[model samples]
Target: MTMIAVCALWGMLFSVLLAEPVQAADLIRALMFQEAQRVLITSGRGLVRQFPDGAEQVMTTPVVVTQLDGGMTLNGARAASDMVKVRGRDDDLIITVAETPVSDQPQDRLSDKVSDAAGSAVPPAELGPPPMGALRGPAPLHTLVLAGAVQVIRRGKSLMVINEVDLEEYVKGVVPSEMSSGWHLEALKAQAVAARTYALYQRMMNAGRDYDVVAGVQDQVYRGRRGVDERVQQAVEATRGVVLMHQNAPVFAAFSSTAAGPTEDAINVWSKDLPYLKGVECPFDANSPYYRWRAELSLQDLENNLRRQGIAVGTIASVTPFSFSRAGRVGRLRILHSEGELILRGTDFRRVVGYTAVRSTQFEVQSVGRTIVLAGRGSGHAVGLCQWGAKELAELGYSFAVILTYYFPGTEFNNTRFGAQAPSSTP
Candidate 1:
């Protein structure tokens, strides 16, 4: 059969498997690499490349994609075009990149990178570190097995790699990447639903953009088919096409590692008040490793980080909690510096200091000598569902439905086909 005929047949088969009519929104465009200069892509079972002008070709060897002056180069040969789409013939697409080495010096430990809107920085327990790199320097190659078609689009001087995959398959990639598959079956189910809802919500919000969600901590960690196991598959299938709905639309459905104390209010964290994201007493996550931890950073380093973010500060003299939220998490901080004083929001403070360093805003600050010591509870921003809390609840025999309702109060379950519309107000 021709490629067009085969693609039409596959579409019909996919719709039949779904047991529902497929729509344009049923697919998720996940941003895998943004503005990357180079990437290595191949497939074990042959590959198919589609051009912008509706042409296709089959390849059996690996292809290196690099940005050019105007267009791009395929294996050092110019393609004369700015965009290309590639997919595996019958196997998963493998993307490879060289890994950057981590610095060993203590002074170089501070990372200026900031977390996304959700402020989730905790790594998945089962899937160690994500296969994350844009390939800047030469090093050991790290391979990522992805189950979707990748679009390589060149914008100006750099190239972007986006994975366009089925919504259900996207959720499967997210479940094991966010939470461990070995956890209670109920917790995994809850995570599956949340991941699905969050993805749909993002798709709705980003309809005007090129992609829906990013495959990283910025959005939800999606490692394609890397960590998917039987349990993860079961969890996804059990709650297939289900999402948390609020007023006939999917909620933001934010989640985090641990809410050591009470879950936070979205109004306090992101300044967007959703009726379902109210704070609630959460005492089930004490077993979490990040429940209570201490992070110390030198005053000089803090000042440097603050300056890097365009916050003018001469030398940090003292850092004190200026205000507290209703959940008792720090709301703002008063920094005394050589120049003067600056009031920084707790969320901005977490951004200035690495998310991994400060962990959460529910912390006590102590300026001892030349270092600032922070004793904090919780991981992530403490908004919406708490994964560790859900684990404990699942262990205590709570059903996934009950766990989801407990975290996202006043939210109802709805099929993705019906309730995946954009809300009247963006969260």
Candidate 2:
């Protein structure tokens, strides 16, 4: 065969080999999995249409919804049937399911309303819980699917992902207790997003597999700490309006409960060197995977050395309750910070090639006051996935193939994307 033909064949063969499933045991050790949340259903129209019962109603447009419960009855508003429905054009929908009887909650809707001298009506922030008459009856399980969505109000600028079962519980139960102080909403939202994204990614990658190695790659990347990313944000929003059932009520929750510990005071992020960043430029996004890798490595080294000293030092786990930040001198490497806590600090150049000992004459930690702090360095957890490093490698004009290989090290990205099917297990 000609040189070009041989090369093409070699590439094809290599791609196929990479796609083969690794040993289940090995895969399990390397993979991480989480529950699916904030799922974005592309074919949801059909799924909604499949619900049996005329209970589903399209209150709005293509943004289909369904009532999970019935109307309140303070002055006698009867409970309505719980239903689910997809939005359709004004008259084209031809629903075939029989309508379910309404399980209206008896509510005195008018009892709370009183007209002032000016005849202006107002709503109270603490109307207290809906009157007993209002909650006279509970709606069907399915109907809640929609009612829950409508009840969610806009807080500040963003809408809460009310549909998430876990977060709903946090909002209802945890928030009242001030689990993390007045910043519950902001902190929980961040966690929920991170959790939802991590969950969805796991589901997508492990649809039918024994494990999700990519997640494991990430876990290793963070040295087993909570790692948040853009994907988490996407999942949190996409699954909005879905009610999370925690002990039978809605609430908010964080990405990792452990990550949201006692409310902390502010933190300060400081520079190690006077001209700390001697050669490296500061990074923009601290949550990016790049810094995460640096963190993993530093912690790993810490753990190993600690073990040698016969100390029971645990691995540096991510996702602890902490805000985010960044650091580094102008010419040195940059790093990510959390709540003034240096989660990752860049090492002097000589360290990258496995050299140890402080080359720098000075090293210190700085805090930038935040509720939760993250301090440490290198950039990301020094692990299997160094995304920025990969990018730099990519910029070296390396092929995507080489980039993934270097970052992932031992693993390979499947050239043939797998179908969304559950993989059969070898029990």
Question: What TM-score do all the candidates reach, one by one?
Answer: 0.83, 0.24
List candidate 1 stretches off by more than 4 Å: 1-25, 52-55, 98-129, 134-140, 415-427
Top-TM-score structure, candidate number: 1
Q: Residue 197, candidate 1: how far off, in angstroms?
A: 0.8
- For 141-187, candidate 2 gives per-residue lDDT tens digits of 21112111111112232111122123322122211111122221333
Query: What lDDT score belongs to each candidate, Candidate 1 first?
Result: 0.76, 0.25
Instruction: State in Å the error of residue 21, model 2.
Output: 13
Clashing pairs in model 1, backbone N/Cα/C closer than 3 A: none
Error of 2 at 315 (Å): 27
Can you write out model 1's per-residue Cα lDDT over 275-382, one digit (the tens) per residue? 999988888888777789899999999898988899889888899999999999999999998899999999889878877677789999887898989999988888
Best by lDDT: 1
Native-vs-model 1 lDDT? 0.76
Q: Report each candidate's C-alpha RMSD, comma-separated, in the order given.
A: 8.7, 21.9
What's the true lDDT of residue 152 in model 1? 83
Query: Lowest-lDDT window of 10 residues in candidate 2?
Result: 256-265
